[model samples]
Target chain A: MNELFQKVLAENSILLFCYLIGSITFILGLKMLSHPASARKGNLVAAAGMLIAILATIFLYRTENMSHLGNYAWIFGGLLVGGVIGTLAAKKVQMTAMPEMVSLFNGTGGACAMLISMVEFNKIMEHHPEEMHRGHLLIIVLGAVIGTVSFAGSMIAWGKLAGKIKDKTIPGAQIINFLLFAGIIGLSIALVAGFATTLPVFYAILTLAAIYGILFVMPIGGADMPVVISLLNSFTGVAAAFGGFLYDNPVMLTGGILVGSAGTILTILMCNAMNRSLKNVLLGSFGGAKPGAAGAAKEGGGTYKEISMNDTATLMAYASKVLIIPGYGLAVAQAQHTCHELEKVLEEKGVEVAYGIHPVAGRMPGHMNVLLAEADVLYEKLLEMEDANDQMSSTNVVLILGANDVVNPAAKDDPSSPIYGMPILEVEKAEHVIVNKRSMKPGYAGIENELFFRPKTSMLFGDAKKVLQELVTELKQM
Target chain B: MFQEFAAFFITNYRLITIVILSIFLGIEVISRVPSVLHTPLMSGANAIHGVVIIGAIIVMGSAEPNDFVALILGFLAVVLGTLNVVGGFVVTDRMLEMFGKKKPKK
Candidate 1:
């Protein structure tokens, strides 16, 4: 149409194209990630797209200026500071914290969204403070509100994972959350009505968002955090996408959509790990077994027969099929490699060894898998809850190696318990069950494992690593 | 890099889509037949995040007349990329730390 407009479009075409490509990469990469085998490639292709998108945007923006070398200097300084911190953190953070780190990154994205929206708002205010079109102004205000809330909310989620925020109910949490929501909404409405400006009400809304974030997450126990973390991550993405709308940026919209959808899907998966519906995860207090439930009531009554390492090794060495159910106990004792050593010794004796991993065995999803993977256990040797359970009943010996809640038969038998309907590894259903544990302190849910007292169940008391070591030594003699 | 392909990319996005889909699916289908070929999915993702460092480089290098908005975005990009780099290595370290550990008495 117009020559100048055409020139502007042409000048920025590469950025626009890069944004589109990055969006496509994000979409296809996530789809390919459905299967664990191709997930890495999917991640790579998507990351390439992200790099292209950001660089294109930055380069296009830089073309508008050429004389301010000091401005370039500041950008350089930011790079150096960020590069050192980010690289060092990534190099040092544990795999278990991957999900948390993801949350933190998502929070940072939200921060960008908030900062950009604020900058734009300030620019508009400085330029045309008196010419507020109520409708357009409303859009910007709404974007700022959503973006700011998402930023603070995601930050709170990150804090929870970083140990900056502790999980304890700050008395009257629900009442306070309700008040904050009402106050923020009222303030937002007042701003739109031209009765107030962000100068006063903005900070007030921010305080509410911060409190809401704290109150929202502090009530959720550590066990149910994955779902919460993923949910907040998606919130951050949505916030960024909204900020894009405020700036009229097509690339931001597309990238944000991909992140939002993928993050939401991850949240759903995390919920399923806990056998929880999205609604339940948000509104219900799930995970810990309620008092006087089956695990607690039967705690003192069940006859938990004990076994020595030698006897445990004898059974494992001779058994035709041995299923090892590993849990947080294994992680707590860091016995994964020793377990692998024991498995190898059994394999040498012509015994089949497979590890049974429950969906929510440890504090987070895939906790046991990472531990076992570090032990250099073959990926094929690890069976998911469904796969491992199908074969458990046919196995000769089911070794409950330091797992607690995952292999507990009480979960299957007790309907009144909190984790009642959650899917669990059927190590309890195996022909012979041998439990390794240090004490009967109950699991994180405070539930006694009925698998311990089953007629076939016998406790082998020792640290997971030491017990596995002793078992390996005994199996070597066999 | 693909200025010549721009026309094809604009007109036939399907061709690029098909090529990428085939490569990824090919690797995936191959893995299913042999479980030992478990794809290094996490490591691959780590590498992708690593590519952000290159993006950071570009952003830092190309800020000619330095748009404040672009500068801010670039600064954030570097931080994000570095976190991934350091965190990935740290996880590898801690995982390595877990090897050969024995369980204490239950």
Candidate 2:
């Protein structure tokens, strides 16, 4: 008995030490993540913490029954298969597809949390069906509901962002979604109240929550995808936290809480950047089919003046200061490298060149920075929207490359516009504004840009990459 | 019933404290990040949640062989959790790799 007691005591102490180390490393890693230079090392540090936690659970914490080779095979097999597939996918996916991949991984976390809850519920039902505690049942229900919703919702977000799913809403879909959400809550309460069979009720809640998840995201437009993705990510984190609560594992609990809070903070920041509330994003159903041609056809209000490549080259080549504003169009064209080249050429000509990056310029937060950084653009050349706006007035010329909505004057001048009050690049403040695009079509927000029709703004119509290349060639001749 | 409630709180107060402390720390840390690293940070946090795989392994190990449903669920959880952890870290690392310093020779 004494030996058994000592063994138990030693194991508990070891588990405590591991949890402490894991928590500290996670904290340190996240602290390092605040800066770009140390972010990679931060990730590795957090990964090391995870490894320690996993090792402790496997060797020190497992029960005697789990010592069987069959259990080991399943556990290691999962790690090997998942590790290989995840590594390959991460390696193969392009930077442009990063947001979708993040959503996919977030869904996997949600799935694991949901499965844990389900397995735990089954275990309890089989062993202690007669003495179920309400608190335990509540945690299980919350984990299942939130996790299933996050998993399903993230998949839809991934599909929508990846162009696999169309952003179409069935009539009265919002009402139906509300009803499904209410139904899930009601069923969860009933399960806790012991009014029905535990297993079926649990599954019913899962199914309803899954449906609610799909319906919740189906109506949201592409413009709101980043917010939705962040929100769903937080949901998954919260669900995982509930799983942690169910198991009383300190490391799991800390990790889940950390992710949950961080995701929530990001969601809030993205919402503020768009000047929209979370409720509006969820219910406003902002984005849909590209704004029809009728909006642009009503162009009698103003006409856009087109500038040829030679003229554009002359203007940029002689300019004292030039600001380049890049948007999703640049990303779609994969022209960041060429854009960087243009910056270099202009810099060599004694012109001060800098980038104006709107906070929400690309599909995801900081997306423009990633694209430009990939092309080895100097970090100092990239300016935040506020700083760029501060210098826009004295700027001799502003080159808007495949960027529209962020530069749209409607954000400030037109109160009737949907994107009104949203922060923009204010590129029109420059003396000369040149916009590079394929045509006069509206941007992703499906709104015609008032800046396009301004006298100071000249449309340089073409693919951003080809236009930049042609302009570079023209500048060389000049 | 009151004594049972107190006992529950006594057993779980430490966990509740950890959860609250971690949440505050998370928010504080995340708020300091520049917008440029938001995507990578989000992906990194996603991977951290894969720590749930430990829960899965523990549950599966303790599960009886006859408990087929629990076994299957636990196994799938392990797979999904591993994927989240591995994919999240690798993808975040790839993204951070692109944010290199300016080349000296060039």
Candidate 3:
């Protein structure tokens, strides 16, 4: 073989080796991520792979290509800005705000793809304007049109997540949404018809793309964010891959392909969780007008008992064993840190502390766990409902923080309630149940939480974090 | 070494993108399960974002263009790309919060 040919093969081998190693790391990361016990290890493994890949790439780069140095400068600068922003958001966002964060990530990923497509357009226009072949042009136009829609659609998702777009059903929203999608698809087909070089066609496609994005995600609500987030993330991946094709870059193509495929699959999975399709979830205004029924139900079965933080803390302090039950309300109030402090105080008194976690405790899956981890709680202390329920008989006190649904006895007894079969924290089996909540309002599923009205349960109504803090202060006194 | 990969990556352009995006989406799907594993998925995905920092190498390697617009845009992509990479790590670390201990009910 020619020496230059051999050298090229060797280089390819090295890069391929690096890529495989990185891919293995990802697989290992996923495997380890299957449970909390191994998550840290998985993260470390994945990080190691990333580190290796980065190092390998640096080693492979030829010194001859010095002109692309500006890309490095941009990369580092982006790291600085994005890093700060991400850090601040993580630190500041309440546990309850995680769904919103997911939504924002969905938006950001789409925007990044959109921007990548724009850059690709510039590259094609400047370097190979006349050389643009039909296939490449098709990819370019598809990228621009899709990328734009994803970007604006993700923003609308953000709005829905933020409650800026109210849950109220708007007349003709569905028809309008369908028309927008159809029109965008039609324009996209036209865009691929080798007419992209025309200015009016290009601009019109751009307008339609932007509008389509907004309309695409506008009807989605907070309840369906996880699915939307996954779908949009997949869209970003596809867009990125197309951008990679335009640039003839192997890395982008591979990376984009991975993201797009993975995202699509995940979107499907999320949809199944809600027993809906991507189309229905995005267009049907899911969870519409149903929660209002819960609002009304909350008004009935309204037996009342209230307690102050100090009183609640005194009970917690005196108890020899305590179990904390967290739900969406806990996440919403960002009370994890304060709850951690309460855990510490209770533990100091020789109280055995445990947390009962339900499968569907928050808006998104694992919502409660994320919040508790933020408060610096031990991973071992959290027991699943099945595991913890067996122990509830011996539990002296069950502190319900920011929880609404998971403790409701109606799940086991009332056939009429929506959450009848769903397993919950068996707090009723405990000696005492102390629930800290914002109000008597029903949870996302809109069922009245009978736990709130239980005779043994004392309702400490206020903000969850604030009440947790107060309880901590009182625990200190006790 | 990561810097080198970063440079190689930006230079190679799109070689890694398709694979990365596919993996990302796959993780997204897998992580949606309300099981004990979602956090780990996020952490792993985040670890892959280390690829973003390589954008620095790309920025440094690309030529200074005669026309400033593409140059500026390219520069911006690299910068943002790098930010996304490092930020991904930080976010991954935070995601580890999913492993918090649940207090025993008894």
TM-score of 2: 0.93
Report lDDT per candidate: 0.60, 0.84, 0.63
DockQ of each candidate, alpha-carbon based = 0.10, 0.62, 0.23
lDDT of 2 at A91: 96
Q: Candidate 1: where is the Cα deviation over 4 Å?
A: A1-7, A62-70, A133-166, A287-301, B1-106
lDDT of 3 by residue, A1-478 (tens): 5986677668757866876787666556655655556666766776677667655655564434321133444444555676677667656655566556555654554455555555555666666777655555567677667667766776776677666776545678777767876776676566555455554666576677887677666656666666776676667657656665654544445545555665566566545543456776766544565667676776677687987677777777878899998876777666778888889988998888988987556656566677777677887787877889999999988988777766778877988765566566788889988887787766655567777777888888888888877778888877
lDDT tens digits by residue: candidate 1, A1-478 = 4986666677567666776686577556655544454444565566567657655655554333431123546555655675577666655665545546655654544454544445445555655867665544555565556555655665666777666777665666668878988887888778766788655576576567667766677766655666676566556555555544444455445444444555565566666666678876665344323444544466466577888777887877779999988876786677878888988899999999898878666545666766687678877778887888799788999888777776666567788655677788876567788888888666756566666777888888888888888888888887
Q: Per-prediction RMSD in angstroms?
A: 8.4, 2.8, 6.7
Tens-place lDDT digits, model 2, residues A217-246: 988887578788888888887887887788
TM-score of chain B of each: 0.52, 0.86, 0.46
The segments of candidate 2 whose C-alpha lies over 4 angstroms from its true place after superposition are A63-70, A288-300, A476-478, B1-10, B100-106
Give model 1's docking category.
incorrect
- Model 3 DockQ class: acceptable
The residue ranges of model 3 lying beyond 4 angstroms of the native Cα positions read A1-13, A48-106, A125-131, A153-169, A195-200, A244-254, A261-286, A295-302, A307-320, A408-421, A454-456, A475-478, B1-34, B43-64, B97-106
Per DockQ, what order, best first? Answer: 2, 3, 1
